[model samples]
Target chain A: MGDIDIANDTVSADVVAKFDLPAYLHSQQAIVASHLESALEPRYPERLFESMWYSLSSDGKRLRPILCLAGCSLSGGDPELAIPTACALEMLHVASLIHDDLPAMDDDDYRRGKPANHKVFGEGIALLAGDALLAYALEFILLNTRQVPAERLLRVMHTLINRVGISGLVGGQAVDIECEGREDIDLETVEFIHTRKTGSLIDAAMVTGATLAGADDDTIARLSRYARKVGVAFQIVDDVLDVIGTRQELGKTPNKDEKSRKATYPRLFGVDGSMQRARELVDSAKKEIAPFGQPAVPLLAMAEFVCTRTS
Target chain B: MGDIDIANDTVSADVVAKFDLPAYLHSQQAIVASHLESALEPRYPERLFESMWYSLSSDGKRLRPILCLAGCSLSGGDPELAIPTACALEMLHVASLIHDDLPAMDDDDYRRGKPANHKVFGEGIALLAGDALLAYALEFILLNTRQVPAERLLRVMHTLINRVGISGLVGGQAVDIECEGREDIDLETVEFIHTRKTGSLIDAAMVTGATLAGADDDTIARLSRYARKVGVAFQIVDDVLDVIGTRQELGKTPNKDEKSRKATYPRLFGVDGSMQRARELVDSAKKEIAPFGQPAVPLLAMAEFVCTRTS
Candidate 1:
């Protein structure tokens, strides 16, 4: 690839208007899926790998990884350089899902239109599978990522780990679990939970990609802000879907938030109000990356997709 | 510190004879403890941090981190340089223990003479705490490790993650769980479980330290072989203690392996036979690292400690 100065790289309005988001998503999803398949081949202690792959292979929107690649491409870096990190993001996301569906946690029996990991592999293996995936994600990134400077890769590893730890997803989930069935939860508390629980990984995905691509600090910061807005909007849409969508459309049990007495965006704001909020966030997310022009098309479209996804 | 070529560094018999193993262990343990204490400070989302710190602060041998430092020191590197990775090793070890004690896993109600994590913090929070610790261990290494080349740090990360994932602890745990009550489990299978479940992280600890210290490939290989033997011996000692040691001495339930019908060294061979095997392995471990002479005192002493410890 030619050394394109990403700071000054721009495309005409006609080129930006011609972008096809669905095609972009489809192609990126295919690339991510292929890599994910080979990223963790089943090995000895076959059952454990089986359990890990079960959740990993189940169909879901490969949003985080796709966003990671998009961030790399937007910064004029080779998208291939970000593929391993992208795969790592998906592994982490699936791992969180498996653990979240455990009996002591959300206790859901289904995920992505299939039996949950624990339901099929039993809780013990399911839990270990989740643990394996979490650890392996880092291993995969370190082993497979090529041509990237070691310093940048270390930064990527640091970002991903930070987002997964107490300051981010774990802390958010703890508060969410603690506040379940409590009527005292406020909008601020809900936002706190959503931002960390869901938003942290989403932000990490973009930031890691940009950092790996050697994007300037300002560009990384812009992408991070864009991710933060979209992440919140994504969670709001999920809450709304859980309240209104069917099991078929949602792929898991619907109305679970109500059943668990969990506080949500729709609980505080009406469904219409929640949708309006998501729309506003999506618009703001797009605005955050507007300076990147045509290169930002995939990210802007993803933000819209997050606001509108049924499952 | 003056630059000493580790390959040529040696001590006379008089100095080696005067080395106080107990004092070395005590000092190293104290150093590791202090670092671990500051490694994870309590933060907001008070309950989550509380749960994490509760298990982490619970007293244990701190053996893994000490071994890491010993490996670094043996290679003529500053022990301080290895401290962060050493603490990461301990964190990873503690995280595994927390998860292992869960109801869905080992169902243990006690650990280190106190209620197990799940017993005190509910299964959900305990699980999350384990997850947080696992993720934070990597984060701590990346953020705290200094003066090491980024390539070495990445290699350390790769080594740690590889051991924690399916090929190591998780895979071993899975097989152990699967073979819980099976009479068909053979000596080879038992060794497989013990080696990976207990040995993998032990191997990672030493390897990470040596790698960070820029140990030669041959030196790393010797240390690795030393760790493998010591790790197996360590687990055998643990199994023997479960059979004969009191709860006060073991700091947990005794004979729980018999209760669970988990295959173990003592179960296959009597306690006498198990102890003999451990002694043999410890001797072999010492032989592997004998070339390092006086610098190998700590590691050699630790192997002996592993074979002889009551708990």
Candidate 2:
């Protein structure tokens, strides 16, 4: 049976009970969420800060930064060492969302069931706010931060930038834009676009967390594999939900992928095949965590959660 | 009479005879130029790198980075230690120029008498190239290939990011955009725009050079004063040139400022008053260096050069 099916049975309850994770998860959320808010406190232009904070404050799973923390924890390193870097990833994610919502791109009037940034902040300010957030994200990684080796810090920056740059997020975005209105897309194209659009930074986030904690090369390599599988599964689930989910459940417009005629797993592979592929990817991601044993439980659970999430 | 007038009539040959620069400058330029080229090499898309490098390699005075090197030399630091950072600033400058040239801002189709980045590279590529350059610039600093002291390396990054953030370059750009098309901008508004836009990075570059070399706070402060004077003077000359410079000499369309009716010193102060203020600023800038005596000769000459340059 798929992990999602198992999760719907008694196994998930046992996993949660065994881990005793509610308090830990809530505590981590509070800390991570507060750090994200504080990291975004604007030193100038109150409106820009308000706009950025407004979007960031909106409801969503704090998935990536928490995964960064989890990756650090799994490697026996302090999550505190990776907090700013994690926040940086969150900031970058928000920037992409803001830009993706532009009239020229996805043209979405709503995000998370609320008016999009461009809708409320004015297109120009929203555009600049995204740019400011991106620039500030890098600044957060490189400046006013505590101890990490200079060379390692350099690596952190290099990895983040590379993941966020053309070969990663932006390049994926270009292809995604081009993909709009096209009916012909294969699995490879979907994978290529998703890998860059989502996978690169997700990969960067987990790897950065581990690296910041001084994890060994092999451990980092494994974490990268885990992140990649999870990333792909995450995107697939998102695509599936857009086809099946209600607007209220998803907290945004439903069926956008279908309505836009955007290439997606459901459109390309049929619903069952898309579901099978997601499960396989999740299994592969879990396998990468096998050596980490119990310490890897959270990551594995997170991956399952990503694939099975209703919204 | 202007410094150029004096140079042509009385001191051109004698100045050249007495103050010929060492061969190190040529070597430094070659090394820095190579690092610059290598930094922007394309990865995913072949055309991306070429588009980025084209503007960066365009002929113009690389005054800010060169000033960084000179400050490093004056502080008795290894010039090589300053080289990558020097290149980083140039990259940053190029990034700013790309963004500034967008249709939303200066709207210049031509820069340095050639098609602007948006005109040549397309807007999407131009935006990504600028973003990539900034990311790479910070990465270069953190890499610190020269083995700068850990504390010093941290300081250099702190200075650069702080000066480049909203309170500095980005903030300056926002204000400049706001000031555009306004006919009644105050002196304070103009000063705020110029100081943050041009002055902060220049000051950071010089002060960072000294701070890296272990210069005391007082000396770094003095260097800052020198940079501020020259930076403001440079902008004033740019403003003056917009009114009087020929297309060939300016290497850009000279009549845009007037045609657009952008706020400028020449527009506000008239030709003669703006020139007078620039000269006064240059004198005050020179006075800031009086304590350094002959050691500041190069900096003084640079100040004069800023005021006199047609382009």
State how far residue A147 of model 2 sits from its true place (Å).
5.1
lDDT, residue B34, candidate 2? 73
Q: List residue ranges in candidate 2 displaced over 4 A.
A: A1-27, A104-107, A141-144, A147-152, A178-189, A246-248, A251-263, B1-31, B142-144, B246-248, B251-253, B258-261, B293-295
lDDT of 1 at B62: 86
In order, candidate lDDTs are 0.88, 0.75
Clashing pairs in 1: none
User: Which tens-of-lDDT digit does each residue in A1-311 have in candidate 1?
Assistant: 23335466444544544677789888999999999989887688999989999999999889899989988998888999999999999999999999989999888998999999999999999999999999999988988999998998889999999999898888898899999889888999999999998999899999998988898888889899999999999999999999999999988999999999897999999899999999999989887887677778778767777876777
lDDT of 2 by residue, B204-240 (tens): 8798877777777767887899888778878878888
Fnat, model by model in order, equals 0.93, 0.20
TM-scores for the candidates: 0.96, 0.86
**Weakest 10 consecutive residues, lDDT, candidate 1 chain A?**
A1-10
Look at candidate 2 and give me any clashing residue pairs: none
Enumerate the candidates' DockQ scores in order.
0.88, 0.31
